[model samples]
Target: MTFELLEKLENKINQAVETIALLQMEIEELKEDKANLAGKTEQLQSDNDRLNAEHQQWQERLSALVGKIEQAEENA
Candidate 1:
């Protein structure tokens, strides 16, 4: 309609375009961060599994040792 109104509209359009660009960049960064976090989570899960296996093995060994100690004390 008027020149002033057209100028204001153009400024608003430019700002919207800039805001959209910033939002898109932020979204990309978040996606990358999520991928990295997922990979780290998988690695931690693997480590936990290995540790659990080792713990079970150690528990069995300890139980056997305790049994032997009890038997020795009984003999004494």
Candidate 2:
């Protein structure tokens, strides 16, 4: 091949290597973002579970209080 052709091929190879490196860095950043989002999702799920349990407990207490009131009315 001519010298000019060889030089062009070398330039193309270098550009490809640089592009691959940049893409790899972007992939790593994306992975880190995904990990952070997953952690936040887990924390939100835990909070939801806790709130639901408290709501259920309050509902049970309210139901018990209502039953007592109804029983007292019947007795009176």
Q: Which portions of model 2 show Cα errors greater than 4 Å?
A: none
lDDT of 1: 0.99
What would the per-residue lDDT of candidate 1 be over residues 1-76, giving only the tens digit for each residue? 6999999999999999999999999999999999999999999999999999999999999999999999999999
Give candidate 1's TM-score: 0.90
- Evaluated at residue 55, the lDDT of candidate 2 is 100
For residues 1-76, what per-residue lDDT tens digits would candidate 2 score against the true structure? 6999999999999999999999999999999999999999999999999999999999999999999999999999
**Residue 57 of candidate 1: its Cα lDDT?**
99
TM-score of each: 0.90, 0.84
